[model samples]
Target: MASKTLSNSLVRHLMKRGYAQAAPARSETIQTSVLPNKTFIAGVDTNSPVARVTVAFRAGSRYEPQTELGVSHVLRSAAGLTTGCASSFIIARKLAQIGASVSASGDREFVYYTLEATQDNLQDAVEILASLISRQEFRPWELSDNVPRLKYELAALYPQVRAVDLLHKAAYRRGLGNSLFISPKRIGKISSESLQHFAGANLTAARCAVVVVGDNQDKAALVANCLQLTGLGEESKAEGSKYYGGELRKEMGGDLAHVAIALQGAPASSPASLALAVAAKALGNGPVTKWGADNSVLAKAIGNIGPFAAAGFNVSYSDSGLFGAVLSVPKDEANCAVKAVAGVLKKGGLSADAIRAGKNQLKLQILSEAEAGTSLAESVAAQGLTTGNVLPPATLAAAVEQINESTVNQALASAAQSKISMGAAGNLAFVPYVDEV
Candidate 1:
């Protein structure tokens, strides 16, 4: 049995290494700052002339109060409405005419407004973003026009997206989850007056970050223009709390089965975070680790003889972080799947080869993101928010190099002791019967 396991592990390792060898290497420079929360990153792709610009802010859903749940999202939508140079509609239309794309999103931790345009249109794009960030008029008619549309979209997304949102809600506390875009009732309650107040209070120059990725040799002038437009002074302070204090819970219901689990993981700065990520990949990744196989202990014991449409785990980090798995299984096999997952957690059977493969895969995935201008900007922005600096490739390389069998085992042990919060989203009901996994 030992020899067989070792042979299987070796085969998997070689297969994964083959995939890694084929991934292209990416090069980029990431510049970071704290006082102004600015990031200037450039992805050097010789073939593409397209550049991506992003103006990100700390003012995401987490800043929203219970009464103002969906207001941040609404603010993101209205950011470009009527700036000094152009109205939001005209700006969007002009960008489209120039083959540029502009969009925005509000997450639990931040709000990101992005613009992608060709190198020729870089300056115009930056001006457009700067105006949207600093000079948005929030016209009454624009708000009136957009509020209902946003509400309608939110209403439409609720039933379909409820499972993931509920998982976040159960994992993070009520306020944080609501901040992360689960605000059906709050969406209905927001008024244009309240949205204006929220935007004015939160979307200040001090809270914003500008990340430009392209061959814009005139970066200094762009930065100066952004500073002048924002009127950001040294005295201005960004407002918001970074810590989320909460417990994880599992909620089960309906015909479709959803299993969401969360445990307190390492801070973004910890070297062990990479290991924790590798462990998650080992236990949950199907194409990479064979952890989702039907004959595997988890599947066999669950009596789940067929393939799972989706089965994976996610690791989320802020000041504090959570790592957990969510699986979709048939109603009849739900209990078994849960027990099997719990069994793996208890046994801590994560292999060395699996850890190495996961690290390689994750590294490659990060590289792919770097190949895209917008993704690269978001990557740096997220890392800056979490660690107060860009997590450089050298840092990630060192962390991955240090991960081995012993370290992976240690990470698994840490996760085993972690607070596990589980949730179900689909056709079947899931319940946590016992605590000691």
Candidate 2:
């Protein structure tokens, strides 16, 4: 009897493991429901003890009106201030008692409130998130108190960080061009009234979603219901962004030089966006280890240009995208690598072997990130906002598999023809002009 039981258990384990290896598509399961108030909920029951929930609003820096610039940044910093139901201290205490961790962040596209806690505390977590978003008290004193914190945080941005910010300004110049961090100059201009008005107009049910990654389906559903009852306003879309590629340059003190060159790419909803992602993978996405070497096309092309580090990226938004490479090198050696990078961009060619390798790497990265709790929740919320649902892993794999040499060449060629959005910060004398590249 004992021998028979042991054999059965071994067979069961092998069957589960073998099936997962044989069919990766079946490994991910998603359940989605849209509430009567137009609040969307995407839930994945991973059966893990720890859970993550995020309420994502379409409110972001890009949505800020001209008169209310930097209000989104202030709103993010003031996430848990005094709500209608509870003070900031009481809110924090409640979450602490339930052993939950919470944070809020804003970007060019969205602002999200994320809560991480045990499955048992999920209900309390949801209530806290709902209260924080709907009942946020935009008192003048509370808003003023967080301004110094924002200033201190903004001061810590390094040259590389500043260069990326300048890159967007060079690329879009307006909507998507909005800075992710609040400018110190504009911080004083933002007022509590502006934040309250911004939240009233943008933080509505039509533009929000609740995403959960955990084992308890019941608690997630309850959270969704709680959000619907908040009576948030109707959804309103932001103005579409137009890409007019130009150049932005700034001189700073660092001995190293930072440069970003970008051209117009495809939007997030476009099928060509998948091809661009695959092309980026082939170009290079950084090395796996500190000591590991990258042998991608871009890496090999610039190998003789002197000691420098570079990575290719494809930044997609709802309406537009920026595809390019960012390079960092010694001040004296910057231009040499920039020329090499431009040459590689103009000739964007990919072999069959490289395409296959890129597909595998992209697949691995997507699946690996989905395995984490908070990451999966964020993915669900962000994708739900964009496409009304998340793209399954298998669908993503299929899209990537269809990419070929011609597809990559065409994507890069289009970018090359567009006006280049160029940025250089630190040791500006050695940085090349956009036309020169």
On lDDT, the leading prediction is 2
Residue pair clashes in candidate 2: none
The prediction achieving the highest TM-score against the true structure is: 2
Residues 99-172, model 2: lDDT tens digits:
99888886677888888999787777878988888888788888778778898879876665677679888887
Superposition TM-score, candidate 1 onto the true structure? 0.79
- Displacement of the residue 118 alpha carbon in candidate 2, Å: 0.7
Model 1 CA deviation exceeding 4 Å by range: 1-25, 33-48, 155-161, 216-224, 227-254, 288-303, 346-349, 430-437
- After superposition on all CA atoms, what RMSD does each candidate show versus the true structure? 6.9, 9.4
lDDT of 2: 0.71
Global lDDT of each model? 0.55, 0.71
Assess every candidate by TM-score.
0.79, 0.89
Q: What would you estimate as the lDDT of candidate 1?
A: 0.55
Model 1 lDDT per residue over 192-298, tens place: 67876666666655555556666432453354346453433233132222323333433445554555555556655566666666666555344333332333233
